[model samples]
Target: MITDRLSLGLQLLRIIVAFMVGGYAINECTQGFSSEKWPTVKGKVTSSTIKEVFTRSGTSHHEADIHYQYVVDGKTFKADRIIFGGANFRSPKELIEKFKADKPVEVHYKPGEPSVACLETGVNFTVLIPLVAFGGILAFMAFADMSKSMQPNSSIGPRPASNSSGLAQPKMQQVKGIILFTGLVAAIFGFKYGINAIHFGAIPGNAIAIVVLVGGGFLFVTFISLLPAAAGMLARARRFDLAEKVAKLNTKIASTMSAHSYETAVAYGLQAEIAQEQMKYPQALELSKKALNVLACRPKVDLAVNKFDDSTNRMIKESTIRYEKHYNDTESLCNESYGSILFDMGMYGDALTHAEKAKRLAQDNLRNAAAPDQAGTKRALAGALALRGKIELAIGSPENAKSDLQESIRLRKEIPHQFEEYLAASMADLASAYCVQSEFRMAERTIEEGLKIVEGSNKPSHRLAKAKLRAQLADVKMGMGQLSNAESLLMESLDVREELLPAGHPEIAKTYLSMAKLRDLQGKQRDAIGYRRSAGEMLTNCFGPQYQAV
Candidate 1:
């Protein structure tokens, strides 16, 4: 069919044209492709000379342009958005070795203007690579199309007209077109509605509003898109191995970026997490790395903002290393605050170490602080020590854990005005320690007492305490062979969790396991087996297969 050949040729031409247009757009947005400025700068070549030069206050020889001195290029210039890398060089020798001497050095300047001297040449290609890649890809696609067009048509067999199906073909085409058009409309509507929803809520792009907006968007989109993607994923998830599809999806996501760097990373990371939760581990990992890279490229902020991000990233990506390493460069109080975040991430060793270090740092900083700052220092120290205690418990070092927890509780109690709800974890750990010691009565009593103190005292709403108490009570009753009592308590906990958590939460799995035991006691063999299987699946999903109960 002449129509078929023409259609194929048109499709190829469209693709080639689109790529060229996209490449041009990307190049223009990124600045002239060949002259894209390097983000990094270098000063005099030195092996050891580390110093921070803010964009605003670099020692400038010329009043008009911003000039800074570095070991690589003793007197270098700066462009816009200068930042400090983790490495701090103290000597020229160190700088030389760390950064190869022969490396091209470029200086960046602010106030993007023609001939404003914004970027220096010979710097890292972070800014240049993309501009070149997009252009090159477009050029390559154009050449490939020309080659295909020149190929002999003898090898391209035209499909013979289907005489029997000819009458049905138009209907099939209509159906396909309708379905595709509907999906396209749905996707566009979803995007517009999603954006509007966030706007109506006045979600802050940089403030706490971001969290609410992102969380709400995730919930909403998941609620809407889940059924379709899931159905599609499931049908093929089993019929066809998802390895190739997942890989392609991952590659697509990794290459895509939003307007903002950090936002892009967060999006990728969250998408990865969503994929992972849906049993798509490969896609999850791929998206997660893309998210991380996006975050890495984000602009640097103030100390408090940076610390907040460190803790937040830990929760989002489930790693404390970012918090710990970054904390060392931050204020002592912020570092101490980050310790508790590390504890929450279950990085017990790092948590303990960082907490103690933070405590010592805070105490030292406090002694050095003026009288006006003493209160803040003491508050920080209490938080640090309290977090240290919780970390101790997580590692199963009860004696030390107890000591730390008790000290933290005492300090927190002493500072009623500060309202340190995070310290409540110390109490939770203490009760857990009591449970481990087989002091059920003592454990129950302690949780009750602590619950009272935390009930309305701004200590996480006492819900956490209630959950822990329920879990412990269930276990205790089960141990005592009070199957019915245990079952009731477990069910209550499960109900509470079901109300509070998502479908596959780890706590839900734990509750299922407890219920499985009760089911076994009642001789509900099928039910027990199903419950165990579910619990196993959830545990595997949350903590992977290596996690064993203590």
Candidate 2:
């Protein structure tokens, strides 16, 4: 009885929240200022005051700012309060400096609500709908509780079917549960749609209308037809929920196991190949061992033995045990996956070993080709070859690096889509080689050509390619003593790289390091130290703390 009451209470809470969100959205939609009423206007910041300040436990703090303005919507509406609150904002000193610079500011203000002024404007509906829907749900749940209260014997009853004893079972509990579940699913969709609408501009407008109508029709019919059955299910502890969870877990384990196997194999093989290139035998052997362990296991008793609740887990265990021999034989795939992981980690030798094994398997049909040659295989081959060249270059074998890079370029040209990105990548590698060899003119041309190929790609890699090319072009210009040109190109590349790559990614770290070196060369020790710190932070994030060189 208490459980039923609590469930009803939760439903009411949900309804109330939903209704509030919807109401807010509708109000905003209907009364949100028109362009005429909220004309765009320039404002000078008369004074900015920090109204409240608070420190969170750690390295973060929050504060609210009130800005007084002299202008509003082309009419002088003075003493307006514009609230600004954000966690981890730029330091107050930095903000004050920016303000003191007297930067031109653009703002929008509603006529009656001066506090509602905004600097940047973007439309979003996600915030409104969910809150309203929750409010509505809360109200409905409360009403349900009150209605139940009117009857003294209002406990959720048992489900109905004429059993051997010939008594009709009650199913009120099941009905309530189904209703609550349906409402939760609806709430989830509402929240998803709301978030996407606000953040991604993928407002669920027409699609949402269709869904609501269709879903409402379905629920109405189901509520009428399965009313008795739903009540029955809710009345008893349903096995369906636990079964579903176990089923999902089984799927996840299978998928993750496959992925883990593949990554392990690839990382292993890559280390082997790179080791062969660099003649690092010990490292290669270690990587191979890591790959082998991906499938290694020990026997143990079942931890969860509940047949009713954990049947799916037991089934997975039995199947895996039955296929242990087969899995052992197929462990090479895991090694290949591990090798790939190593390659991505900049472990060139290990990446090559895996690539070699994958190449052989793919050609011989020993491994499952994800799709056709058009899938990842083609790119993988090209990348492996290029990485091999890079490893050779790093180990002081310039000639070998050149040869491998050329082959990679040739392989990339044969592919259909994403060819531009591949070409840009190969060219970047080639330009690096040319730069190292002091072939400035050839390096410049290669970088330029690479940038041209990236033009139509429009992918993030395209931007990355452009950044790399510009960076290399700067190097060439610097070599030629065109300091200004070098500076310009390097700065542009730095800006693009900072935007695209994560702060701690190896690529970003390398870019920062380069900038730091350049600054040091220019006798800017302080700037160099700043860049060094940035590079170090990014590197630590991209790779583990133990990662030293790469």
Candidate 3:
């Protein structure tokens, strides 16, 4: 079956090459006619000489190298074009014979552009033929490659292909050819118009239009090429595991240029998060490092915002602000990912450092982001605070943990977000912190509120979070010496966990451990021992014989 990754790569590449090179050639050829309306001036040939030009085949030929000077509005200018591009590659002996030093000529120069002058004004077929021929061949090759990648390898459903972002790959491939064909006319004519704005004068190639178009073209080609490359890397590593695929993707993306750094950082941050979810702390940390490194390569948000006060380009300034916010959001996610990973690894101090970084970045993002991004930005800040609070709780700083988690909960309540389950999780954390302080009533109250949030959501993850909250509530009851109530809560939590989690999940084993403890307190020794054995077996099955539920 044809993989979507290969198809996507070819698709993006075809669009870029078809648009840029084909457009460049078509535009360069067509724009020579614009010089016909240029005003004429009395000019003199300043220099005319023959230069020996060597070919790759070890042969030699001679061509005319000519220059002329003219005056426009009392300013003297020099030029070399006989036509717009001056592509008559005939004998230099003939050109020298026709025009010599101090020879009089009529120079056609653009009215506003004194330097853009030509002795002759008309289309140059010598330049047009080769460009059209070469461009056509490349465009044909691009389409052919696209066609090849879209073919099916099997008669079954579309081949399973997905990117790290989980976009609809097969569907995109089905219509990518149509997209390219429809875009061809627009890209060609737009390139023709955009490129023709370049007026080469005595200075040669000094035009903002040239810089913008060339830079845009280069980015469209090289930077977008990385997407298909990424798809290929992910597809090749499918057999190995997500970690391998993520590693390969990140290694390539991390080496990209500054213009791509924000995207690279965002990709790495997501990879780090996935690694953490898989319980791969070392891989998570490595991916987090890559995210941070790329983020460091991006433009500094503070400096760009500081320049806003003095800038006249309101559109540019707005775009710059948006760019700054994107970086801020990406960097915040990177730091938050690292903080979560380090916290899971029990490196509380190190986790706190990254949590702080994330909090600050999210705060900055909140201040400058566009209206649509406000709620999402607040969620990021809440996430950072929640992570830092968890780390604080782990390190015996209950007061700090309580404060951070409360503010995090407050932020979550302040905005209606899609991550309402996360708000529940933060509440559970706050309850745990309260439990750590021996405030049993406060802990019970917090856990109950968290339960309400989780109970409203039917998502599997939310259900698992509810089970955890249930377990926490049981602990508060056990501390209060409500033995019957505590036992009832444990049994209920175990039911939910068994129904929701896989048999080998660590959470299941931990729930079994709680059941064993509750049984022991109820004076059922044999039942308690059986629960312990079940917990041990679950842990052993998941993480080998040496591992325990704790």
TM-score, one value per model: 0.37, 0.40, 0.50
Compared with the true structure, what per-residue lDDT tens digits does model 1 show for residues 378-406?
56666677677667766777778667667
Candidate 2 to truth, TM:
0.40
Off by over 4 Å in 2: 1-349, 355-378, 544-546
* Candidate 2 lDDT by residue in tens digits, 351-467: 667656644543343243322223234445556566667666766777777887887777666654333554777787787788788888888887877775655343455567778
Candidate order by lDDT, decreasing, is 3, 2, 1
Better structure of 1 and 3 per TM-score: 3
The lowest-lDDT stretch of 10 consecutive residues in candidate 1 is 80-89
TM-score of 1: 0.37
Q: Give candidate 1 misplaced runs (Cα > 4 Å).
A: 1-347, 366-375, 418-424, 454-461, 473-486, 513-533, 546-550
lDDT of 3 by residue, 429-499 (tens): 89889988899999999887777665444555667678788887887887788889988888887887777
Q: Choose the strongest candidate by TM-score.
A: 3
How many Å off is the CA of 38 in candidate 3? 45
